[model samples]
Target: MSARYWALIIFIGSIWGTSFLFNAVLIRELGPITVAAGRVTIAALVSWLLFFALRKPLPRDPMLYLKLGLLGVFSYAVPFTLFPISQAHIPSGLAAIINALLPVVTVLVSHYWPGGEKIKRHKAAGVVAGFTGAALLASPSLAAGNEHGELWAIAVCFAAVMLYAITLNVARSFKAIEPTTIATIAISGAALTSVPVALWVEGVPHIERIETWAAWIAIGVFCTALAFQLMYRLLPRVGTTNFASNTFVTPVVAVLLGVSLLGESIRPIHLLGMGVVFLGLLLIDGRILKIWRKPVSGTEVVSPR
Candidate 1:
Protein backbone atom coordinates (compact mmCIF):
# COMPACT_ATOMS: atom_id res chain seq x y z
CA MET A 1 0.00 0.00 0.00
CA SER A 2 1.10 3.57 -0.61
CA ALA A 3 1.49 6.19 2.12
CA ARG A 4 -1.83 7.73 1.14
CA TYR A 5 -3.58 4.36 1.56
CA TRP A 6 -1.96 3.94 4.97
CA ALA A 7 -3.09 7.43 5.91
CA LEU A 8 -6.65 6.67 4.82
CA ILE A 9 -6.72 3.44 6.83
CA ILE A 10 -5.46 5.21 9.95
CA PHE A 11 -7.94 8.03 9.42
CA ILE A 12 -10.81 5.57 9.04
CA GLY A 13 -9.71 3.75 12.18
CA SER A 14 -9.56 6.94 14.18
CA ILE A 15 -13.00 8.04 13.05
CA TRP A 16 -14.57 4.69 13.84
CA GLY A 17 -12.67 4.46 17.13
CA THR A 18 -14.04 7.81 18.23
CA SER A 19 -17.56 6.56 17.47
CA PHE A 20 -17.77 4.74 20.79
CA LEU A 21 -17.13 7.97 22.62
CA PHE A 22 -19.76 9.69 20.50
CA ASN A 23 -22.27 6.97 21.28
CA ALA A 24 -21.47 7.30 24.97
CA VAL A 25 -22.08 11.02 24.86
CA LEU A 26 -25.28 10.79 22.88
CA ILE A 27 -26.73 8.00 24.99
CA ARG A 28 -26.43 10.17 28.05
CA GLU A 29 -28.85 12.70 26.54
CA LEU A 30 -30.97 10.52 24.27
CA GLY A 31 -32.28 6.96 24.45
CA PRO A 32 -30.28 4.33 22.62
CA ILE A 33 -32.99 3.91 20.00
CA THR A 34 -33.13 7.64 19.37
CA VAL A 35 -29.36 7.91 19.15
CA ALA A 36 -29.22 5.05 16.66
CA ALA A 37 -32.09 6.48 14.67
CA GLY A 38 -30.69 9.99 14.54
CA ARG A 39 -27.24 8.85 13.43
CA VAL A 40 -28.54 6.57 10.68
CA THR A 41 -31.01 9.18 9.45
CA ILE A 42 -28.23 11.71 9.01
CA ALA A 43 -25.95 9.13 7.45
CA ALA A 44 -28.62 7.93 5.06
CA LEU A 45 -29.36 11.45 3.91
CA VAL A 46 -25.68 12.15 3.25
CA SER A 47 -25.29 8.83 1.45
CA TRP A 48 -28.28 9.46 -0.84
CA LEU A 49 -27.04 12.96 -1.63
CA LEU A 50 -23.64 11.56 -2.54
CA PHE A 51 -25.28 8.78 -4.54
CA PHE A 52 -27.17 11.34 -6.62
CA ALA A 53 -24.23 13.75 -6.84
CA LEU A 54 -22.09 10.97 -8.31
CA ARG A 55 -24.83 10.23 -10.92
CA LYS A 56 -25.30 6.68 -9.62
CA PRO A 57 -28.55 4.90 -10.21
CA LEU A 58 -30.29 2.94 -7.48
CA PRO A 59 -30.47 -0.83 -7.87
CA ARG A 60 -33.52 -1.95 -9.81
CA ASP A 61 -33.60 -5.44 -8.38
CA PRO A 62 -36.13 -5.95 -5.62
CA MET A 63 -34.14 -8.88 -4.27
CA LEU A 64 -31.15 -6.62 -3.82
CA TYR A 65 -33.26 -4.18 -1.89
CA LEU A 66 -34.46 -7.00 0.34
CA LYS A 67 -30.91 -8.11 1.01
CA LEU A 68 -29.79 -4.55 1.65
CA GLY A 69 -32.71 -4.05 4.03
CA LEU A 70 -31.70 -7.15 5.95
CA LEU A 71 -28.15 -5.90 5.97
CA GLY A 72 -29.40 -2.59 7.32
CA VAL A 73 -31.34 -4.28 10.08
CA PHE A 74 -28.54 -6.56 11.18
CA SER A 75 -25.52 -4.40 10.44
CA TYR A 76 -26.67 -0.92 11.32
CA ALA A 77 -29.94 -0.68 13.23
CA VAL A 78 -29.58 -3.48 15.75
CA PRO A 79 -25.88 -3.14 16.53
CA PHE A 80 -26.05 0.64 16.58
CA THR A 81 -28.77 0.53 19.21
CA LEU A 82 -27.03 -2.21 21.18
CA PHE A 83 -23.70 -0.40 21.37
CA PRO A 84 -25.17 2.70 22.96
CA ILE A 85 -27.26 0.69 25.41
CA SER A 86 -24.22 -1.38 26.32
CA GLN A 87 -22.02 1.68 26.68
CA ALA A 88 -24.57 3.25 28.99
CA HIS A 89 -23.46 0.70 31.56
CA ILE A 90 -19.89 -0.11 30.54
CA PRO A 91 -17.01 2.22 29.76
CA SER A 92 -16.48 3.06 26.08
CA GLY A 93 -12.97 1.52 26.26
CA LEU A 94 -14.35 -1.72 27.65
CA ALA A 95 -16.98 -1.73 24.92
CA ALA A 96 -14.28 -1.19 22.31
CA ILE A 97 -12.11 -3.96 23.77
CA ILE A 98 -15.05 -6.33 23.66
CA ASN A 99 -15.57 -5.42 20.00
CA ALA A 100 -12.13 -6.91 19.25
CA LEU A 101 -13.89 -10.26 19.39
CA LEU A 102 -15.65 -9.45 16.10
CA PRO A 103 -13.07 -11.15 13.84
CA VAL A 104 -12.87 -14.15 16.17
CA VAL A 105 -16.62 -14.53 16.02
CA THR A 106 -16.53 -14.07 12.25
CA VAL A 107 -14.03 -16.90 11.93
CA LEU A 108 -16.21 -19.25 14.00
CA VAL A 109 -19.40 -18.29 12.15
CA SER A 110 -17.79 -18.62 8.73
CA HIS A 111 -16.85 -22.22 9.47
CA TYR A 112 -20.48 -23.26 9.10
CA TRP A 113 -21.03 -21.47 5.80
CA PRO A 114 -20.83 -23.49 2.60
CA GLY A 115 -17.51 -23.08 0.74
CA GLY A 116 -16.19 -21.14 3.71
CA GLU A 117 -12.90 -21.81 5.41
CA LYS A 118 -13.08 -24.48 8.09
CA ILE A 119 -11.58 -23.85 11.49
CA LYS A 120 -8.07 -25.23 11.70
CA ARG A 121 -6.24 -26.13 14.92
CA HIS A 122 -4.80 -22.65 15.28
CA LYS A 123 -8.16 -21.03 14.66
CA ALA A 124 -9.85 -23.34 17.14
CA ALA A 125 -7.22 -22.39 19.69
CA GLY A 126 -7.81 -18.79 18.78
CA VAL A 127 -11.53 -19.15 19.37
CA VAL A 128 -10.92 -20.66 22.77
CA ALA A 129 -8.47 -17.93 23.74
CA GLY A 130 -10.78 -15.22 22.51
CA PHE A 131 -13.80 -16.45 24.44
CA THR A 132 -11.65 -16.98 27.52
CA GLY A 133 -10.51 -13.39 27.26
CA ALA A 134 -14.13 -12.24 26.99
CA ALA A 135 -14.93 -14.23 30.10
CA LEU A 136 -12.00 -12.69 31.92
CA LEU A 137 -13.07 -9.22 30.84
CA ALA A 138 -16.61 -9.77 32.06
CA SER A 139 -15.63 -11.46 35.33
CA PRO A 140 -15.27 -8.25 37.27
CA SER A 141 -18.80 -7.22 36.44
CA LEU A 142 -20.13 -10.66 37.35
CA ALA A 143 -18.31 -10.97 40.66
CA ALA A 144 -20.37 -10.94 43.82
CA GLY A 145 -20.95 -7.54 45.44
CA ASN A 146 -21.00 -5.77 42.12
CA GLU A 147 -24.26 -3.81 41.81
CA HIS A 148 -24.31 -2.98 38.13
CA GLY A 149 -25.47 -5.44 35.49
CA GLU A 150 -22.29 -5.18 33.47
CA LEU A 151 -22.59 -8.81 32.39
CA TRP A 152 -25.77 -7.98 30.50
CA ALA A 153 -24.07 -5.03 28.88
CA ILE A 154 -21.22 -7.26 27.75
CA ALA A 155 -23.73 -9.79 26.44
CA VAL A 156 -25.45 -7.05 24.45
CA CYS A 157 -22.11 -6.13 22.91
CA PHE A 158 -21.50 -9.78 22.06
CA ALA A 159 -24.93 -10.00 20.45
CA ALA A 160 -24.13 -6.92 18.37
CA VAL A 161 -20.90 -8.52 17.12
CA MET A 162 -22.79 -11.71 16.28
CA LEU A 163 -25.18 -9.67 14.16
CA TYR A 164 -22.17 -8.02 12.49
CA ALA A 165 -20.77 -11.45 11.63
CA ILE A 166 -24.09 -12.39 10.07
CA THR A 167 -24.03 -9.14 8.11
CA LEU A 168 -20.60 -10.04 6.73
CA ASN A 169 -21.96 -13.33 5.41
CA VAL A 170 -24.93 -11.51 3.90
CA ALA A 171 -22.56 -8.99 2.35
CA ARG A 172 -20.62 -11.74 0.58
CA SER A 173 -23.79 -12.57 -1.33
CA PHE A 174 -23.94 -9.00 -2.62
CA LYS A 175 -20.51 -8.99 -4.29
CA ALA A 176 -22.07 -7.75 -7.53
CA ILE A 177 -23.35 -4.59 -5.86
CA GLU A 178 -21.18 -1.51 -5.65
CA PRO A 179 -19.92 -0.77 -2.16
CA THR A 180 -21.32 2.76 -2.10
CA THR A 181 -24.71 1.62 -3.37
CA ILE A 182 -24.84 -1.11 -0.76
CA ALA A 183 -23.94 1.40 1.95
CA THR A 184 -26.49 3.95 0.74
CA ILE A 185 -29.36 1.52 0.48
CA ALA A 186 -28.53 -0.25 3.71
CA ILE A 187 -28.25 3.01 5.59
CA SER A 188 -31.50 4.25 4.09
CA GLY A 189 -33.19 1.07 5.19
CA ALA A 190 -31.66 1.52 8.61
CA ALA A 191 -33.06 5.02 8.77
CA LEU A 192 -36.48 3.78 7.75
CA THR A 193 -36.41 1.02 10.33
CA SER A 194 -34.84 2.97 13.15
CA VAL A 195 -37.10 6.03 12.93
CA PRO A 196 -40.25 4.07 13.73
CA VAL A 197 -38.56 2.18 16.55
CA ALA A 198 -37.11 5.33 18.00
CA LEU A 199 -40.40 7.14 17.79
CA TRP A 200 -42.22 4.30 19.47
CA VAL A 201 -39.63 3.60 22.14
CA GLU A 202 -38.20 7.00 22.90
CA GLY A 203 -40.68 9.48 21.42
CA VAL A 204 -39.52 12.76 19.88
CA PRO A 205 -35.99 13.78 20.71
CA HIS A 206 -35.34 17.07 22.48
CA ILE A 207 -31.75 18.23 22.59
CA GLU A 208 -30.81 21.21 24.76
CA ARG A 209 -27.04 20.81 24.72
CA ILE A 210 -25.05 21.96 21.71
CA GLU A 211 -22.22 19.59 22.58
CA THR A 212 -24.56 16.63 22.59
CA TRP A 213 -25.96 17.54 19.19
CA ALA A 214 -22.44 18.11 17.88
CA ALA A 215 -21.38 14.67 19.07
CA TRP A 216 -24.42 13.17 17.41
CA ILE A 217 -23.66 14.95 14.15
CA ALA A 218 -20.02 13.84 14.29
CA ILE A 219 -21.06 10.20 14.78
CA GLY A 220 -23.43 10.41 11.83
CA VAL A 221 -21.25 12.32 9.37
CA PHE A 222 -17.69 11.41 10.25
CA CYS A 223 -18.05 7.93 11.69
CA THR A 224 -20.86 6.45 9.62
CA ALA A 225 -21.01 8.35 6.34
CA LEU A 226 -17.45 9.49 5.65
CA ALA A 227 -15.88 6.34 7.06
CA PHE A 228 -17.96 4.13 4.77
CA GLN A 229 -17.12 6.34 1.77
CA LEU A 230 -13.41 6.11 2.50
CA MET A 231 -13.71 2.37 3.05
CA TYR A 232 -15.30 1.81 -0.35
CA ARG A 233 -12.63 3.94 -2.04
CA LEU A 234 -9.74 2.31 -0.19
CA LEU A 235 -10.86 -1.33 -0.35
CA PRO A 236 -10.19 -1.79 -4.07
CA ARG A 237 -6.74 -0.31 -3.76
CA VAL A 238 -5.72 -2.15 -0.56
CA GLY A 239 -7.56 -5.47 -1.13
CA THR A 240 -9.93 -7.13 1.37
CA THR A 241 -7.33 -8.68 3.66
CA ASN A 242 -5.47 -5.39 4.09
CA PHE A 243 -8.69 -3.38 4.50
CA ALA A 244 -9.97 -5.84 7.10
CA SER A 245 -6.80 -5.29 9.10
CA ASN A 246 -8.32 -1.97 10.16
CA THR A 247 -10.03 -4.01 12.89
CA PHE A 248 -6.69 -4.30 14.69
CA VAL A 249 -6.14 -0.56 14.65
CA THR A 250 -9.68 0.59 15.56
CA PRO A 251 -9.81 -0.85 19.07
CA VAL A 252 -6.46 0.67 19.97
CA VAL A 253 -7.62 4.10 18.88
CA ALA A 254 -10.95 3.64 20.66
CA VAL A 255 -9.15 2.66 23.86
CA LEU A 256 -6.88 5.67 23.71
CA LEU A 257 -9.75 8.07 23.01
CA GLY A 258 -11.90 6.61 25.75
CA VAL A 259 -9.16 6.93 28.33
CA SER A 260 -7.85 10.34 27.35
CA LEU A 261 -11.00 12.10 26.17
CA LEU A 262 -13.67 10.34 28.16
CA GLY A 263 -11.55 9.87 31.30
CA GLU A 264 -12.27 6.15 31.36
CA SER A 265 -10.13 3.72 33.37
CA ILE A 266 -9.52 0.08 32.47
CA ARG A 267 -8.61 -2.47 35.08
CA PRO A 268 -5.36 -4.44 34.84
CA ILE A 269 -7.23 -7.70 34.21
CA HIS A 270 -9.14 -6.06 31.38
CA LEU A 271 -5.85 -5.06 29.73
CA LEU A 272 -4.61 -8.64 30.01
CA GLY A 273 -7.89 -9.80 28.53
CA MET A 274 -7.49 -7.36 25.63
CA GLY A 275 -3.98 -8.71 25.01
CA VAL A 276 -5.26 -12.28 24.87
CA VAL A 277 -8.10 -11.29 22.54
CA PHE A 278 -5.66 -9.55 20.19
CA LEU A 279 -3.43 -12.63 20.22
CA GLY A 280 -6.42 -14.69 19.13
CA LEU A 281 -7.12 -12.21 16.30
CA LEU A 282 -3.50 -12.49 15.14
CA LEU A 283 -3.76 -16.26 15.18
CA ILE A 284 -7.00 -16.13 13.18
CA ASP A 285 -5.34 -13.88 10.57
CA GLY A 286 -2.42 -16.43 10.50
CA ARG A 287 0.04 -14.17 8.64
CA ILE A 288 2.25 -13.22 11.57
CA LEU A 289 2.54 -16.80 12.78
CA LYS A 290 3.09 -18.03 9.25
CA ILE A 291 5.93 -15.55 8.72
CA TRP A 292 7.61 -16.61 11.98
CA ARG A 293 7.40 -20.30 11.01
CA LYS A 294 8.71 -19.84 7.44
CA PRO A 295 11.88 -21.66 6.36
CA VAL A 296 15.13 -19.80 5.61
CA SER A 297 14.90 -20.90 1.94
CA GLY A 298 13.88 -18.14 -0.42
CA THR A 299 10.53 -19.76 -1.35
CA GLU A 300 7.08 -18.27 -1.63
CA VAL A 301 4.70 -18.96 1.30
CA VAL A 302 0.93 -18.72 1.29
CA SER A 303 -0.94 -18.00 4.50
CA PRO A 304 -4.32 -19.54 5.30
CA ARG A 305 -7.44 -17.70 4.21
Candidate 2:
Protein backbone atom coordinates (compact mmCIF):
# COMPACT_ATOMS: atom_id res chain seq x y z
CA MET A 1 0.00 0.00 0.00
CA SER A 2 1.06 3.56 -0.64
CA ALA A 3 1.50 6.15 2.05
CA ARG A 4 -1.83 7.75 1.21
CA TYR A 5 -3.64 4.40 1.62
CA TRP A 6 -1.84 3.83 4.90
CA ALA A 7 -2.94 7.26 6.09
CA LEU A 8 -6.52 6.55 5.00
CA ILE A 9 -6.52 3.29 6.93
CA ILE A 10 -5.29 4.97 10.10
CA PHE A 11 -7.67 7.91 9.74
CA ILE A 12 -10.71 5.73 9.13
CA GLY A 13 -9.76 3.35 11.92
CA SER A 14 -9.28 6.18 14.44
CA ILE A 15 -12.56 7.90 13.53
CA TRP A 16 -14.56 4.66 13.65
CA GLY A 17 -12.80 3.59 16.85
CA THR A 18 -13.89 6.81 18.56
CA SER A 19 -17.49 6.21 17.36
CA PHE A 20 -18.18 4.04 20.42
CA LEU A 21 -17.14 6.88 22.71
CA PHE A 22 -19.32 9.27 20.77
CA ASN A 23 -22.27 6.89 21.07
CA ALA A 24 -21.63 6.54 24.79
CA VAL A 25 -21.73 10.30 25.25
CA LEU A 26 -24.71 10.84 22.98
CA ILE A 27 -26.73 8.07 24.61
CA ARG A 28 -26.26 9.80 27.95
CA GLU A 29 -28.34 12.76 26.74
CA LEU A 30 -30.53 11.06 24.13
CA GLY A 31 -32.15 7.69 23.72
CA PRO A 32 -30.35 5.08 21.63
CA ILE A 33 -32.96 5.37 18.88
CA THR A 34 -32.60 9.13 18.85
CA VAL A 35 -28.83 9.00 18.68
CA ALA A 36 -28.91 6.38 15.91
CA ALA A 37 -31.52 8.34 13.96
CA GLY A 38 -29.71 11.66 14.30
CA ARG A 39 -26.37 10.28 13.19
CA VAL A 40 -27.80 8.65 10.04
CA THR A 41 -29.85 11.72 9.19
CA ILE A 42 -26.79 13.90 9.52
CA ALA A 43 -24.69 11.41 7.55
CA ALA A 44 -27.28 11.24 4.77
CA LEU A 45 -27.30 14.98 4.38
CA VAL A 46 -23.53 15.16 4.26
CA SER A 47 -23.32 12.27 1.80
CA TRP A 48 -25.94 13.81 -0.48
CA LEU A 49 -24.07 17.07 -0.43
CA LEU A 50 -20.92 15.27 -1.44
CA PHE A 51 -22.82 13.41 -4.13
CA PHE A 52 -23.98 16.68 -5.65
CA ALA A 53 -20.54 18.23 -5.28
CA LEU A 54 -19.03 15.30 -7.13
CA ARG A 55 -21.69 15.57 -9.87
CA LYS A 56 -22.81 11.99 -9.32
CA PRO A 57 -26.26 11.04 -10.45
CA LEU A 58 -28.56 9.16 -8.12
CA PRO A 59 -29.66 5.69 -9.12
CA ARG A 60 -32.89 5.91 -11.12
CA ASP A 61 -33.81 2.24 -10.89
CA PRO A 62 -36.56 1.50 -8.38
CA MET A 63 -35.17 -1.97 -7.67
CA LEU A 64 -31.78 -0.51 -6.81
CA TYR A 65 -33.44 1.96 -4.47
CA LEU A 66 -35.34 -0.88 -2.80
CA LYS A 67 -32.13 -2.84 -2.31
CA LEU A 68 -30.39 0.17 -0.85
CA GLY A 69 -33.31 0.79 1.50
CA LEU A 70 -33.10 -2.76 2.79
CA LEU A 71 -29.40 -2.33 3.19
CA GLY A 72 -30.14 0.76 5.23
CA VAL A 73 -32.40 -1.13 7.60
CA PHE A 74 -30.16 -4.14 8.13
CA SER A 75 -26.79 -2.44 7.83
CA TYR A 76 -27.30 0.98 9.33
CA ALA A 77 -30.49 1.37 11.34
CA VAL A 78 -30.58 -1.96 13.14
CA PRO A 79 -26.88 -2.27 13.98
CA PHE A 80 -26.57 1.41 14.86
CA THR A 81 -29.45 1.15 17.34
CA LEU A 82 -28.21 -2.14 18.76
CA PHE A 83 -24.68 -0.91 19.42
CA PRO A 84 -25.72 2.07 21.49
CA ILE A 85 -28.29 0.03 23.42
CA SER A 86 -25.62 -2.58 24.14
CA GLN A 87 -23.16 0.09 25.17
CA ALA A 88 -25.63 1.13 27.86
CA HIS A 89 -25.02 -2.16 29.64
CA ILE A 90 -21.42 -2.84 28.62
CA PRO A 91 -18.25 -0.76 28.41
CA SER A 92 -17.41 0.70 25.01
CA GLY A 93 -14.20 -1.34 24.93
CA LEU A 94 -16.07 -4.60 25.39
CA ALA A 95 -18.53 -3.62 22.69
CA ALA A 96 -15.68 -2.79 20.33
CA ILE A 97 -13.91 -6.03 21.13
CA ILE A 98 -17.03 -7.97 20.27
CA ASN A 99 -17.00 -6.27 16.88
CA ALA A 100 -13.71 -8.00 16.12
CA LEU A 101 -15.75 -11.12 15.53
CA LEU A 102 -16.98 -9.74 12.20
CA PRO A 103 -14.54 -11.73 10.07
CA VAL A 104 -15.30 -14.95 11.89
CA VAL A 105 -18.99 -14.38 11.56
CA THR A 106 -18.60 -13.46 7.94
CA VAL A 107 -16.65 -16.62 7.31
CA LEU A 108 -19.33 -18.76 8.92
CA VAL A 109 -22.19 -17.03 7.12
CA SER A 110 -20.38 -17.26 3.81
CA HIS A 111 -20.06 -20.99 4.18
CA TYR A 112 -23.82 -21.38 3.63
CA TRP A 113 -24.20 -18.83 0.87
CA PRO A 114 -23.84 -19.86 -2.80
CA GLY A 115 -20.64 -18.76 -4.54
CA GLY A 116 -19.04 -18.17 -1.13
CA GLU A 117 -15.64 -19.30 0.06
CA LYS A 118 -15.40 -22.81 1.43
CA ILE A 119 -14.21 -23.18 5.00
CA LYS A 120 -10.70 -24.58 5.01
CA ARG A 121 -8.95 -26.16 7.99
CA HIS A 122 -7.31 -22.91 9.08
CA LYS A 123 -10.57 -21.00 8.80
CA ALA A 124 -12.32 -23.68 10.85
CA ALA A 125 -9.68 -23.36 13.50
CA GLY A 126 -10.08 -19.59 13.36
CA VAL A 127 -13.82 -19.90 13.86
CA VAL A 128 -13.36 -22.10 16.90
CA ALA A 129 -10.68 -19.89 18.47
CA GLY A 130 -12.68 -16.75 17.77
CA PHE A 131 -15.86 -18.09 19.38
CA THR A 132 -13.85 -19.34 22.33
CA GLY A 133 -12.50 -15.86 22.83
CA ALA A 134 -15.98 -14.42 22.61
CA ALA A 135 -17.17 -16.94 25.21
CA LEU A 136 -14.30 -16.02 27.48
CA LEU A 137 -15.13 -12.36 27.14
CA ALA A 138 -18.79 -12.92 27.92
CA SER A 139 -18.28 -15.44 30.75
CA PRO A 140 -17.90 -12.79 33.43
CA SER A 141 -21.22 -11.23 32.50
CA LEU A 142 -22.86 -14.65 32.44
CA ALA A 143 -21.50 -15.35 35.91
CA ALA A 144 -23.08 -12.08 37.12
CA GLY A 145 -26.44 -13.85 37.47
CA ASN A 146 -28.26 -11.78 34.85
CA GLU A 147 -28.72 -8.93 37.33
CA HIS A 148 -26.65 -6.42 35.33
CA GLY A 149 -27.86 -7.85 32.00
CA GLU A 150 -24.36 -7.77 30.55
CA LEU A 151 -24.97 -11.11 28.81
CA TRP A 152 -27.91 -9.61 26.99
CA ALA A 153 -25.73 -6.66 26.01
CA ILE A 154 -23.05 -9.02 24.74
CA ALA A 155 -25.64 -10.91 22.72
CA VAL A 156 -26.91 -7.66 21.26
CA CYS A 157 -23.37 -6.68 20.27
CA PHE A 158 -22.93 -10.05 18.56
CA ALA A 159 -26.19 -9.47 16.72
CA ALA A 160 -24.88 -6.12 15.57
CA VAL A 161 -21.70 -7.79 14.35
CA MET A 162 -23.76 -10.35 12.48
CA LEU A 163 -25.64 -7.55 10.79
CA TYR A 164 -22.33 -6.01 9.83
CA ALA A 165 -21.22 -9.28 8.27
CA ILE A 166 -24.48 -9.55 6.38
CA THR A 167 -24.11 -6.01 5.15
CA LEU A 168 -20.65 -6.72 3.87
CA ASN A 169 -22.05 -9.55 1.79
CA VAL A 170 -24.89 -7.33 0.60
CA ALA A 171 -22.47 -4.62 -0.41
CA ARG A 172 -20.26 -7.12 -2.22
CA SER A 173 -23.20 -8.46 -4.20
CA PHE A 174 -23.72 -5.03 -5.74
CA LYS A 175 -20.56 -4.96 -7.77
CA ALA A 176 -22.03 -2.86 -10.56
CA ILE A 177 -23.07 0.01 -8.30
CA GLU A 178 -20.76 2.80 -7.27
CA PRO A 179 -19.88 2.89 -3.59
CA THR A 180 -20.81 6.55 -3.18
CA THR A 181 -24.21 5.96 -4.74
CA ILE A 182 -24.85 3.00 -2.46
CA ALA A 183 -23.72 4.99 0.55
CA THR A 184 -25.96 7.95 -0.28
CA ILE A 185 -29.05 5.88 -0.91
CA ALA A 186 -28.48 3.57 2.06
CA ILE A 187 -27.85 6.44 4.44
CA SER A 188 -30.93 8.26 3.20
CA GLY A 189 -32.99 5.14 3.70
CA ALA A 190 -31.56 4.70 7.18
CA ALA A 191 -32.45 8.29 8.00
CA LEU A 192 -35.97 7.76 6.75
CA THR A 193 -36.43 4.58 8.78
CA SER A 194 -34.79 5.81 11.94
CA VAL A 195 -36.58 9.20 12.17
CA PRO A 196 -40.01 7.71 12.83
CA VAL A 197 -38.61 5.19 15.29
CA ALA A 198 -36.80 7.94 17.13
CA LEU A 199 -39.82 10.15 17.35
CA TRP A 200 -42.01 7.29 18.52
CA VAL A 201 -39.54 6.01 21.08
CA GLU A 202 -37.69 9.11 22.29
CA GLY A 203 -39.65 12.11 20.99
CA VAL A 204 -37.78 15.13 19.70
CA PRO A 205 -34.33 15.47 21.20
CA HIS A 206 -33.10 18.72 22.79
CA ILE A 207 -29.46 19.77 22.79
CA GLU A 208 -28.29 21.66 25.86
CA ARG A 209 -24.53 21.30 25.60
CA ILE A 210 -22.33 22.30 22.68
CA GLU A 211 -20.07 19.34 23.38
CA THR A 212 -22.87 16.87 22.90
CA TRP A 213 -23.85 18.49 19.63
CA ALA A 214 -20.24 18.46 18.53
CA ALA A 215 -19.86 14.79 19.31
CA TRP A 216 -23.04 14.01 17.39
CA ILE A 217 -21.80 15.92 14.37
CA ALA A 218 -18.40 14.27 14.58
CA ILE A 219 -19.91 10.81 14.44
CA GLY A 220 -22.10 11.60 11.44
CA VAL A 221 -19.52 13.53 9.48
CA PHE A 222 -16.22 11.91 10.33
CA CYS A 223 -17.19 8.41 11.34
CA THR A 224 -20.13 7.64 9.02
CA ALA A 225 -20.03 9.90 5.97
CA LEU A 226 -16.32 10.54 5.55
CA ALA A 227 -15.36 7.07 6.62
CA PHE A 228 -17.60 5.53 3.96
CA GLN A 229 -16.15 7.81 1.33
CA LEU A 230 -12.61 6.88 2.31
CA MET A 231 -13.40 3.18 2.33
CA TYR A 232 -14.99 3.38 -1.08
CA ARG A 233 -12.01 5.19 -2.47
CA LEU A 234 -9.46 2.91 -0.88
CA LEU A 235 -11.21 -0.36 -1.65
CA PRO A 236 -10.25 -0.44 -5.31
CA ARG A 237 -6.64 0.39 -4.61
CA VAL A 238 -6.05 -1.80 -1.56
CA GLY A 239 -8.61 -4.55 -2.17
CA THR A 240 -11.04 -5.69 0.50
CA THR A 241 -8.70 -8.25 2.02
CA ASN A 242 -6.01 -5.65 2.67
CA PHE A 243 -8.57 -3.07 3.70
CA ALA A 244 -10.02 -5.50 6.23
CA SER A 245 -6.94 -4.95 8.39
CA ASN A 246 -8.71 -1.85 9.69
CA THR A 247 -10.73 -4.20 11.89
CA PHE A 248 -7.59 -5.06 13.85
CA VAL A 249 -6.66 -1.43 14.36
CA THR A 250 -10.12 -0.12 15.26
CA PRO A 251 -10.68 -2.26 18.39
CA VAL A 252 -7.30 -1.30 19.79
CA VAL A 253 -8.10 2.36 19.48
CA ALA A 254 -11.52 1.81 21.01
CA VAL A 255 -9.99 -0.04 23.94
CA LEU A 256 -7.51 2.74 24.51
CA LEU A 257 -10.18 5.41 24.37
CA GLY A 258 -12.35 3.43 26.73
CA VAL A 259 -9.50 3.09 29.19
CA SER A 260 -8.05 6.62 28.96
CA LEU A 261 -11.05 8.79 28.16
CA LEU A 262 -13.89 6.84 29.71
CA GLY A 263 -11.80 5.38 32.57
CA GLU A 264 -13.22 1.90 32.05
CA SER A 265 -11.45 -0.98 33.71
CA ILE A 266 -9.94 -3.78 31.63
CA ARG A 267 -9.42 -7.09 33.39
CA PRO A 268 -6.56 -9.42 32.52
CA ILE A 269 -9.05 -11.82 31.02
CA HIS A 270 -10.16 -9.17 28.56
CA LEU A 271 -6.59 -8.74 27.37
CA LEU A 272 -6.17 -12.47 26.98
CA GLY A 273 -9.42 -12.75 25.09
CA MET A 274 -8.45 -9.89 22.78
CA GLY A 275 -5.11 -11.52 22.06
CA VAL A 276 -6.73 -14.82 21.23
CA VAL A 277 -9.30 -13.17 18.98
CA PHE A 278 -6.61 -11.27 17.10
CA LEU A 279 -4.60 -14.42 16.63
CA GLY A 280 -7.69 -16.04 15.17
CA LEU A 281 -8.18 -13.10 12.84
CA LEU A 282 -4.58 -13.39 11.69
CA LEU A 283 -5.04 -17.07 10.99
CA ILE A 284 -8.18 -16.45 8.99
CA ASP A 285 -6.50 -13.73 6.98
CA GLY A 286 -3.76 -16.26 6.06
CA ARG A 287 -0.95 -13.74 6.32
CA ILE A 288 1.12 -15.16 9.17
CA LEU A 289 0.78 -18.64 7.76
CA LYS A 290 1.83 -17.39 4.33
CA ILE A 291 5.29 -16.67 5.76
CA TRP A 292 6.23 -20.33 5.20
CA ARG A 293 4.66 -20.51 1.73
CA LYS A 294 5.87 -19.37 -1.68
CA PRO A 295 5.46 -15.68 -2.52
CA VAL A 296 2.56 -14.60 -4.71
CA SER A 297 3.03 -12.18 -7.60
CA GLY A 298 0.11 -9.80 -7.15
CA THR A 299 -0.48 -7.16 -4.50
CA GLU A 300 -4.09 -8.19 -4.05
CA VAL A 301 -5.57 -11.32 -2.50
CA VAL A 302 -9.08 -12.45 -3.28
CA SER A 303 -11.34 -11.49 -0.38
CA PRO A 304 -13.92 -13.91 0.97
CA ARG A 305 -16.51 -11.82 -0.79
- Model 2, 1-305: lDDT tens digits are 78888888878878889999898888888899999898999999999999999999877899999889889888998999999999999889889889988998999988877777788988888889899899889888777787899899999999999999878877878878998998989989999999998999889898897878998999999889999888888888998767777888888898899899988877788778888888788888887777746455445787896
TM-score (all chains, Cα) for each model:
0.93, 0.93
RMSD for each of the candidates: 4.5, 6.0
Q: What do the candidate models score in CA lDDT, each in turn?
A: 0.87, 0.88
User: Candidate 2: what lDDT?
Assistant: 0.88
Error of 2 at 228 (Å): 1.0
Per-residue lDDT over 1-305 for candidate 1, one digit per residue giving the tens place of the 0 to 100 score:
78888888888877888999899889878999999999999999999899999989878899888879878978999999999999988899889888889888988898998767689988888898899889889889878434787888999999998998878876887777888898999998899999998999899999999989999899999999889888877877897656767777777888888889889888888899989898888787778777887774567878999
RMSD of 2: 6.0
Estimate candidate 1's alpha-carbon lDDT, on a 0 to 1 scale. 0.87
